[model samples]
Target: MCREPYPGRVTAPVFVLTPETVEPAGAAATAVAGDRLVLTGPEAHHAVAVRRLHPGERVDLVDGAGLRLVCEVTETAADGGRRERLAVRVVERVEEPQAGLQLVLVQALAKGGRDEQAVETATEVGADLVVPWMADRCVSVWRGVKAARGRQRWGAAAREAAKQARRARIPEVAELLTTAELAGWVRRVNDAGGLVLVLHEEATVPIGGVALPDTASSEAIDHPADEPRGGGKGPQDPVTIAVVVGPEGGISAAEVGALEQAGARTVRLGPHVLRTASAGPVALAVLAQRVGLWG
Candidate 1:
């Protein structure tokens, strides 16, 4: 039987295991209680040296793909070596279910680390996927090596935020998208019956008032089913909800027109204008509640 942990009483620090590390354990490895497991490498070093987690302490090991192992530390390296390892026994293995609605945040790259802040907050607020957008008025241009580095930074930020939030799944940071490419993506998602909302200060529709689609509908079209997200007993086709946030200079009218032409709905959050870093997270929180993700 699976041992249920106390609700709202999380006592252990979370350490994420990469897919490569967790996948080799196979599906049956952590299925039963009292299963022996070892946590090694950088994660273990951080747990022992940085966190000072001693034996008898509890910890949560997540694959960032729905698999979470609740473990009790049985032993720790006594030599205090830099490359230490931690051994634990699994108390329980839980496969977290996917959210009712898959939230996607398409944030335009901005200067002053504002884009990084946006993605970090969005991940903590339950955004399932994040896409970095190169807007027309973006002051921070990413080209060549800079683009790859920027995406890596964003992914790192999201991973840290997910760990802080104790999330079983980490949000994916997609490749950078130009305005035209973003429009194409919007069309593809729309064709799959997904909803895309572009945040505009001048829009007439309030984001809170938009009717959320029923994710339980079996007739819903599948959008990006190959996403690394795992853990569903049966097949489920959840509708994707994408929120677009502009850069520090704001979105250009031409870009807005292109997004609208591609079947995205322009919506306003409130009366006051928000900074680029705050807009997407706010919209995601509002939509998450409306779609029962908060429930």
Candidate 2:
């Protein structure tokens, strides 16, 4: 299906698109908004032919860059028998408020596609960015062409998962990174006043006890950004928390030491150890709730 959740029971089915699909005044958002949009290509065909959605029905469209259009379907027909047409009349254009803190998942490469699974679940849980890590204990290796293909697959997975969750902002899928590179990311996030956490079975600190950005108010972040990646940094230095999860064999003591020296705090998710594919998502869910982004 091309559509997914819309918060409440009566909300329209939501679809995600790239910003390039709708540019200029066509996708231009405004406070008092009413516009016309045609959703063609796969999105239109899936809705029209597959789901059997029709005109006069309500739907929601998002560019995945923060613009969401609550619309009423107007047309569905064969365009010269060459294409399927699904049109909508905009009811309102709403921009979802950016989360005060950005969530990042740094998942280690694991065999049997478990790394991919980790990233997919993390995106659905509200991760703003996903990083594929080449850890010391990783069983899977992404070398040369494999690295490019791996990253591309991760990006596609994150997009599909985000759309399924009906998120307006799709989480970024970064290139496969080595432990040294992961350390650089830690420095970057910390410079921007965010915390980097490593989930270890041996850590003394618990996940819930970690420091978090204020959810009570939009208090400005005190940290200054030395290098800003996306919308996560500003005056608030927007907390860019990164949850690091190791591979099936688990993180090595040496790798743990390296990360801790680079500003990452070793933290435990629970008493029992989780699978490599399960650890990052579990930590992300816990942190999102601690920061009050979830109930």
Candidate 3:
């Protein structure tokens, strides 16, 4: 729903204003036409110094939680490096509902930043969330403080990719998990009536041939509106589709067996095998097409 709908158009040079940035509870929710909003800190610096945005320019601001503000800049000032201010008058405010299908990427650790690249492209291809998995055959491992740093890097990548894609909502990066823990995750998703696909080269079924969840029918089931998504038992939540991508050495037989037992369907992309970095994105592209997300 939108106030003063623009009808089939949005401005460029988008900036994110997450809920954490807003002060005084409910301020953002109450914003209306002609209301002035200020932008400071790193985002303002990018708007003022890097982008050289001038007064009278149009830019879009998103809360990454489905709220988009079509605004016109009225002021821009830079004090120093990473210190600046940008102000805009809100023209229209829109509340976008979540998509019916949620795409999640479960990527295994790999050497040489391949895993990071995988997530970046997947985010660009419309993945809703990313999960880091320490597969049994992984060459790279995250331990101690390194694990936190790795997760932060992946989160940063997803944010940048979202910006490049002009996506209103940025994909979330989940906590790292081991193979055993991933099996439990698969079970939870399956128990909640979601689909989990494990990409394997030897699989008989291709990703295109695999049956996707019927979002139309899923939406018909009665459940509480406030119920959470993914692992929830509620049928009202959007159907989650998680794609599991293994490391360079591929998933071990034991790991595959465990995931299969947990209710994951193993599928292949095509005749040729893709690298760990490219497999997830390729599969996601196919799924996005099959599920009508691309349309």
Candidate 4:
């Protein structure tokens, strides 16, 4: 009943809805042909009033859970509250396939919200998850209540960025972690048959040739029950690409050693040192292509 995003129109407009608005996650939300999908509230207002999406135009609704409902605007009308809305007819529904390679970025917190900016770009570039790493060289600090707020801020940025990029899935933003915790993540990724790469300016190895784990993930995609990721061994698990980016002051030698010791491959992004805000996303773009996700 559902398929992937329409193969032809990559530029089709996409809008996000609350999890409760989608079925399986919530109640009575799945759509079918002839179903009237009343897109209202702020999202509809943005479409009808600001973006001027007229009747008969096509649009897509994604629930961030891989469900993409493709619909056509049937008519334009106003809600009881006087805001404009579009009455859409469900043409088809599709479930987007999960990314072949899970790209996770561990970014060291930087001053002036540079870290948050990095998450925004990373989400746009298809990072499945992100972690805020509080490294020794980081100028910013997150403690107690501040730590919770920081995580919330990063999550919000990811949501907005994913929406702007018209992605069907939004990347996750994890808790702020210490150096020791980062090492633990590397070990977990390694054990799960994933690749963990650290971005170090001084490293001699380039990210280009750092061979990823294996091609097992491509086969796992066809059989969801086969445990495509996590707590799996050999060809059954999906490969994870975790990139660690340091702050403005750069990573401490000790921190780098800790991560490397935990099975992270230290690779340089390029000849020039990149800003803490730009490094992780740039590395992800390179890895995405290398892994054939961009193809």
TM-score for each of the candidates = 0.88, 0.85, 0.90, 0.86
Shift in Å, residue 230, candidate 4: 6.6
Pairs with backbone N, CA or C atoms under 3 Å apart (clashes), candidate 2: 221-236
Show the lowest summed lDDT stretch of 10 residues, model 1. 1-10
List ranges where model 4 is wrong by over 4 Å. 1-6, 19-29, 78-84, 216-237
Query: Any runs in candidate 2 off by more than 4 Å, and if so which?
Result: 1-11, 19-32, 78-82, 213-236
lDDT of 3: 0.82
Worst 10 residues of 4 by lDDT: 219-228
The 10-residue segment with the lowest total lDDT in model 3: 217-226
Q: Stretches of candidate 3 above 4 Å error?
A: 1-11, 19-26, 217-229
- Candidate 4 overall lDDT versus native: 0.77
Candidate 1 ranges with C-alpha deviation above 4 Å = 1-11, 19-31, 78-81, 216-236
Q: What C-alpha lDDT, on a 0 to 100 scale, does residue 258 get in candidate 3? A: 97
Q: Give me the displacement of residue 261 in model 1, in angstroms.
A: 0.6
**Tens-digit lDDT track of model 4 for 1-295:** 1122356755768777664433234421567666776765666776777778888889888776566778888887765464766677878877666645578989999999999999999999888789889999888999999999999999989987887877777777777889999898788888777888999989999999788866543531432422434324655355678899999999899998999898899999998888989999999999878766666
> Which pairs of residues clash in candidate 4, taking residues 3 or more apart in a chain or in different chains?
none
TM-score, candidate number 2: 0.85
